[model samples]
Target: MSSTFDVMVVGLGAAGSSALYHLSKTGKKVCGIDQFVPPHAQGSSHGQSRIIRQAYHEDPLYVPFIKRAYELWEEIEKESGKQLFLKTGGLMLGNSNAGVIKGAELSARTHDIPYTYLSNQEISTRFPAFKPDNDVVGVLEENAGILFPEDCIKTHLEVAALNGAEILKNVKVTTIHTHSDVVTVGTNQGKYLANKVIIATGPWISEFIPELNLPLTVERQVLYWFKTNEPSIRLDNLPIYIWEYAPGKMFYGFPDLGDGIKVAHHHAGEPTSPDTLNRNISPEEISSMKNVISTYFNLNVEFNYGTVCMYTNTPDERFIIDYHPQHKNMIIASPCSGHGFKFASVTGKLLSQLALDEKPELDISLFSISRFSK
Candidate 1:
């Protein structure tokens, strides 16, 4: 029918929800729609917990954004009155020179963050659950911890709506056409038009931005929650841990949170589309991850459960946070390569600035879509 909203955000996940909140704060007419009710298990934002640390092991460029993200997360907590984050400290274990370990050390040094590098003997003495080899060491950033992922998304959406943003859940957008003045979006429910359009769809990004033909591969990852022998050894007592079994091959686990000791491999999975993501976790799959955890912790073997989730990865593993080259009014933000959760709050704020043609204070050149050009 007619048009509404100054901005129409396509997905209400980490990035989109932040955009909605910031835009609404500016008193702009804004609306956000998601394929499913966000904070639901259907998207990457689910799961009970996600890791949040300022010692970015990925790259030094990410340190600034991550630092800002930490601040924004606290701001969101104060505004929403939700205990969405916990600081139980975090451990990064790997070979002294390994990318994961060294990267974190470098970020900590570059940012002047408080961190300590411990040798294998030190690790065993301090954290008994770990058994790193002689050559392996760890960078312990005491501030790193966990974020209640689903609750974070919900808080952002709720605050956005409280500030006068419109949100529609369970309605999928089918098509989008942009003009010089406004953007028109067609969905299963109806049609919407707005002065600006942002497509933050996680796994479904390529479907809308076909021209980019982005090589985004969707892979299925399984999460297993193991029961601990002692309830005290669970989430409350133990800190969050990530270990690099080998370069680019890693396994991470969280403390027991009544659900069990959640463990999962990072970046090792078979390709699949979101619509066809395998929901069933095979017996062999559980065995494989269980074996990895057994090496570090004593598994009760009696109490644990597992579930499947999807990861949308780009070749370089960085995110695509740029807008359409032709349609500058449209922005795309699908950074679901696994580590996007902690940055969701800041990304939302930056994307909102981008929607209004304001440059984000942090450098997003690395995340630009043009980096994919030949």
Candidate 2:
């Protein structure tokens, strides 16, 4: 195999695959390497479905990126000729004064996005699956929906390969050497050199560049699917819902998509390293999730099965999408803080532009690594 390329991307998950695809379109020799075959159950992108919403409660700065991401997803769907997104609408539920509710409302209003604030009675009347307390309300956005994560990743890889981007799967990158001009990436298989390198290896990022001491944490998240006794829990009626059950705690769920309703806590997971992560979901965890479901939703559901995934998180729960402070040729693009798969499409474009030494279309100043220096 040729050991030289214009760009080499480590980690063929969401961001890497998209980067490879966009980079390939630039007619540059680009290659993507992944430790495991993507669309697999191991990473943050593998669940059956992921929620995509415009009203980002985490921060309003994400609205523009997500807006462009929606467009990119549509383009990918048209190019791939596959069903990648499903518009089931979305609901953010919490007390009227809760941070999530207030933040989501703020983003919606600030962006001029179409949304409706519904009272608890209105929520019950419109969405029978929800049973929020009198103090709880919701912000409903019709454009919000679910994205098929595995399918999205697979489509990006397939399209990238079709565009002449090399994909090296099951290859773990051990060390990355950045010289004055080119960057050399060392993997278990062999070494490859590139003019630019993107490190999108998700949880394994710290393993390769410990010198940065990036303050990144890997959290072990559990996803549960439940079989509901009521048919109203199906997708046709139920929308993707996120509830801030407590002040700072959250649990989100999807409508029944044939198999079962998928539910999981956003960030409250066990801190672990990628190499030493425990993939098993304990019964106690299931019971805990069940307790939350029973309290918020009207559906009587039984646990079907659960899967474990990892979230590469930053301290403030924002993404880190800046180039290495010292090595400009080495771009670091992991640690999405759990809610990043939705932005993969636009992120890929941004990373590609950055690698090509071009200006990014969106303002990514909020994701710069220098913020942590202070």
Candidate 3:
């Protein structure tokens, strides 16, 4: 009483959905399953917008990956016949000695990526939306912009379905068991079998293979939207920006897309499981964020609302996107830490290749799970 396929993708969010979409083109019997209807608010992919930039501050190795991702996103955007990406440029703001600015510069210079180094006065002159301190400097990258998260996911799923991939929604996967030839996925409805399975489950991945004790930590992150009367805060005029206020402390914000300008502190939340995360934004949290905003920007922002998402992070913050060590038939990706949505387009293609026993065009040696052991 079950169906079978050549490949199965568990967790149809950023990575899984893309993988399913790519695999569907291989003429293989591929299928994807999700706990809830995707483009839903239950996971990490649902903020109205996510920043996509080329100046890789986290690591320069990510630059090439993002370069390929940009091309793929444009290709999909064209096929979907909808506006999925907005070219708003991007800014990295911090003092001369700040890690955020220095790292971004290092990446830009190393990769020959086009970027401009700006003084605080230059930043104020170019973008009137912010109040940069005298010593604060900036890195301006032209191609960096915003991606509509919900639209991107929906487009991938829609295109994949039209290409003959089966999508199962509202079905919770209870267990995943892999043997010699087939990987069995047991869901609330029934068991499904596949030759190989890509575990792109995002935050809830640990629930599948708890015995591995993978070093992944699920951090509860909040994205806040604020309304400002400042006319210059519109998306067309303002670029997405990351503000490194102190040595390593930072927060990022988006240009107002009519709804409001969005802001959130980077890596500044408590560790929590996906199921037990507190969903509401408290007054205390809002006040703390307001204090940060008031210190960094000149405009008065009224807090609109906050939404919660989880980051499945590794110890070093790099992603784990390789085959399961013990099980060759299983491929696993812990995620690209907190900054992976932009890479979803290219990552999906890589995952599809891995599932089909082909070499990925991009070198993913750095994201191997084995790195965690040493």
TM-score, model 3 to reference? 0.98
The regions of model 3 sitting more than 4 angstroms off are none
Clashing pairs in 1: 234-256, 235-255, 235-256
Between the candidate structures 1 and 3, which one is better when assessed by TM-score? Answer: 3
Candidate that would win on lDDT: 2
- Model 2 root-mean-square deviation: 1.1
lDDT (CA) per prediction: 0.84, 0.90, 0.89
Which scores higher on TM-score, 1 or 2?
2
The all-Cα superposition gives candidate 3 an RMSD in Å to the true structure of 1.0
lDDT score at residue 322, model 2, on the 0-100 scale = 84
Candidate 2 positional error at 98, Å:
0.9
Show the lowest summed lDDT stretch of 10 residues, model 3.
328-337
Candidate 3 clashing pairs?
Answer: none
Cα deviation of 360, candidate 3, in Å: 1.2
Estimate the TM-score of every prediction: 0.97, 0.98, 0.98
On lDDT, the stronger of 1 and 2 is: 2
Could you give me the TM-score of model 2 versus the true structure?
0.98
User: Residue-wise lDDT of candidate 2 within 1-374, one digit each (tens)?
Assistant: 36679999999888999999889898999999998989788878887999999998888888999999999999999999999999999999999888889999999999998999999899999998888899999999999999999999999999999999999999989889999999988889988999999999888888777888999999999999989769778778899988997898899989888778899998889899877899988899999889888888787889999999999989988888889999999888974798999999999999999999999998888899999898
